[model samples]
Target: MPHIYAKYISKVLELPLKRDNFIVYDRFVNERAELFFVSQDGVDFALTLRRKNNRYLIKYDKATRPASTFILTKALSNLAIALECEVENSNLALVQKKESEVSPWLLKPNFFEKNPTFLDGKQAELEVGFGSGRHLSAIAQEFKEKIFFGIEIYKPAALQLLGRIERENMPNIFVVDFDARLFLQTLPSDSLDKIHIHFPVPWNDSPHRRVFVKKFIDEAFRVLKPNGTLELRSDDEVYFKDACGLILEYKTSNFHVFKNRQILVSSKYEDRWKKQGKDIYDLIITAVKKQNDDKIECNFDFENAMDISIAEQICSLPAIVFDGIVVRFEDAFKSESGAFIIKIILGSVDMPESKYIYTRDGISSFYPTKPLPIRDNMIAFKKLKEKLYGKSN
Candidate 1:
């Protein structure tokens, strides 16, 4: 945990921190703090800004996943600048550092589509929400003939796992920082041998945020090979019951329920739960038949990109849609460096496409990285131009 002691100025400044890409959510769940999503270096983290005793403090405590001090430093720096607070006590300033080495084993969403087809004569296993990656690392070490893909939405936890993987030199383990449901949709039908969800976020109050929903269960079945098992171990009885209920709704017979089942590997939370005398429950779903992949045809390459000025004007429009496709202009930010950033949603309303559109020196493109060349995203991209310039290629 990193802390900064400074007398925060209640009066705000019109700082040039707009490029920091700060998007504030009223609040997430029952927390009194405001959830601030900060984007830096193409990666984003949720920072909580809470007011306590008339003192404003920034915290990086969004989910159960952990955040590093190095990351907190960046978040704090941005908050300090935006709030115009001078740091009186900061440990980050105590250490001067050079550019650190970037981890190689971790993959990004931009590289998902072009990922090489591994033909190493080994079955593939995927673990979603590999918090701290203890279970993932152990499974990878034990199963040398099997390829392991660990999907995590938290970048810092993923980065920490990448360093550990580098030190251990595990050859079969691959880390992907992305939404598991979306990533699972990209896999070939009947390709994976196993899918693991250990102590996943219960999201008890918010059922929609759960990973064990109908769509995810369907995707799991689609991506799992015949007789492949999708295992979920959770201590939350509500989550466990909900998961089993979802599987029952799918009308699958090859499912099993185990109570306090002993496994070769355990996560940090699992160990803690065991020590605390908390009973663990397991819901396993085995795929009995191969499922067909959903078809979506798209050509993402646009013949002609729109002009920046016209694109900016178009981005200012209200929600526009065509045949179930929708686009909404969220916000536009201008940096002191003379760059424009627009946050918008494109595609179907249920799962609209999202990416930062950038304009600088009259050139327009997606920032952080381009969207995965998926069919819906391509349609969304076309809608962006069509809505803005009144025509699209």
Candidate 2:
């Protein structure tokens, strides 16, 4: 039912909606404008429009803060109106903005079979949700040889990262314009060496619980090598703690927790959080693939006894007891007679009478009702047992 708005950007803004073949939308507090398109979902979005100088730019609001997806859509609509009027008719000189330089490898897959490389001579690292390419670019600069792949669904962020890659001339980095979770799922097991998730959108509401949870960690673990590191940083305390708990429960390794050293990376969100004096928590968890010995085996014998005892207790009640109660517990024979022989016995009688009326360790049929509709009483008894215990088959 819930869909991301960025996916439908091209179809929403037709020719009739575009003025001067350009549309503008706000990205935070930026007055920058870009060619725009509205998606089929009626969400106004900006695209990279190429000018004479081969420079691309997007226009949007400069002061809007990053909120939910709905807030983003509203800001785009506001930017589109301003872009239409500013570039209405005048043919102005195309001045190239330094940020307009696009990366050749942006939105393309960088890792390949022929050019296999290792991170620190051991593993490869992958990152998701590279916002402004600041942290990613820094990491690319530090670890030049590691296979670093990034995925961003938002066009403006993707374009910004592309420009940053070209500007920095970082060859080790590759970016994709798709959902990173889906991309990670396609990778073979033990393919990645490490994974870095820096401040992903924390879906705090209950309905959005599916967005950020153990599933992502499970996928990360599945793709990482036998013993790989998963480093995650977040200013949201609740999210950080929740993630830590999940890692402890699911990941089989020793976890190390630390406080972020107030390092101002390229992320605007992180910068804002730092300025607001928010405490950032960093959880670095090293997970190893659990061996067969680590698995816990459960005993079902106690559970089976508990089920029968519960049923017997319920059938002993006055409302449930009509004439008497019959309980059948079965165990299969290993001999030529392969059928299971169930011990059926009647309850609520004297010792000798109870033993005489019921079979000791075999199938015993008895009427628990006085009326001709004997099937109804049997159905009721079965239903009562099922509700109290569980399904037998």
Candidate 3:
């Protein structure tokens, strides 16, 4: 997980008084530190307060970057005021540093919500593994009407593109940092016009980790519009041939192959490889059918809260698989009043939905982050509900 830098302040025996501005969680807390979350206008930021070297300081807890620095800055300001303490290095420099580090639009919480409109029903294009974003950046700028979704799990590459998007102010482009294979399942069928995977990791030694798995190809086929093309450009012959073979595994699929094809907007890696006189390969698979979206029914209400001690024991135990769905409690924390929260994973083994379940005031439910409306999660939710509440009933 990435972290934000902060200067030291006075050491305190315990955390400062809780305020409405901060949303704190103790699941990840140990003897040394506590974690708190803050959200501004639906954009979330994290604060890690800890004591080190006889002094106290705060660090921003972020996996990638915060969507809104302004909110974080304001939250910090409010904290300083509410706590009645003076921060030594408090100035515009700190705020500027946070804002300049990443763009606000990079990690908007409701980004997927806007996908439905998708440039007012214009065609949607997706570029998976958009490293350096050389191709994705140019294409998004060129096609203003089309909504472009660039998926890149690489932190630096995604942030670089985020800066470019902020500079160019391209409204049609949305960048997401997640595995392309899992993210595809969240989309509706026939939602994309074109899909591009350029210069992905070969993962030759760990072939199973490669992106062109059978399930991924099947997902691509399901999400793409009829005649929509899934383009893959690669320099690794192993990956190229493997991807081709995976697509061909489906007897109904048709594709076009190219050798040493030209790249319109070359990435840094591509430029370096091309200078060395390396051969490039391109494979384009066109979908022939418009499949229906997978039915998802993963929501349940829990009104009975379990005991804090029991919840903690459950979280520390191994995962349980019910109805082919794997559900595990990752962490447990008890509040001052004995209210407890458990961070959990619910869904298929490959892509489990990570969220929290809060048992407070004699009730429990999925919380902090809602489980995605998917069938695997629904099944997991049913099993979990039964596991926790069945005995009481």
lDDT by candidate, in order shown: 0.68, 0.47, 0.68
| Residues 308-355, model 1: lDDT tens digits | 465457656778877756777765555444555566677655566566
In candidate 1, position 314 carries an lDDT of 61
Winner on lDDT (1 vs 2):
1
Tell me the TM-score of model 1: 0.67
- Candidate 1 stretches with Cα past 4 Å from truth are 1-100, 119-121, 251-253, 288-291, 307-312, 320-326, 331-342, 347-354, 358-364, 375-379, 382-393
Range of the 10 consecutive residues with the lowest summed lDDT in candidate 3:
1-10
Q: Which residues of candidate 3, in runs, are more than 4 Å off?
A: 1-96, 100-110, 113-120, 288-293, 321-325, 351-353, 390-393
Candidate scoring better on TM-score of 1 and 2? 1
The TM-score values for the models, in the order shown, are 0.67, 0.45, 0.79
User: Could you give candidate 2's per-residue lDDT for residues 329-369 as a string of tens digits?
Assistant: 31211111211211123222111011111111233222111
Q: lDDT of candidate 1 vs native?
A: 0.68
Top candidate by TM-score: 3
* Candidate order (lDDT): 3, 1, 2
Candidate that beats the other on TM-score, 1 or 3, i.e. the better one: 3
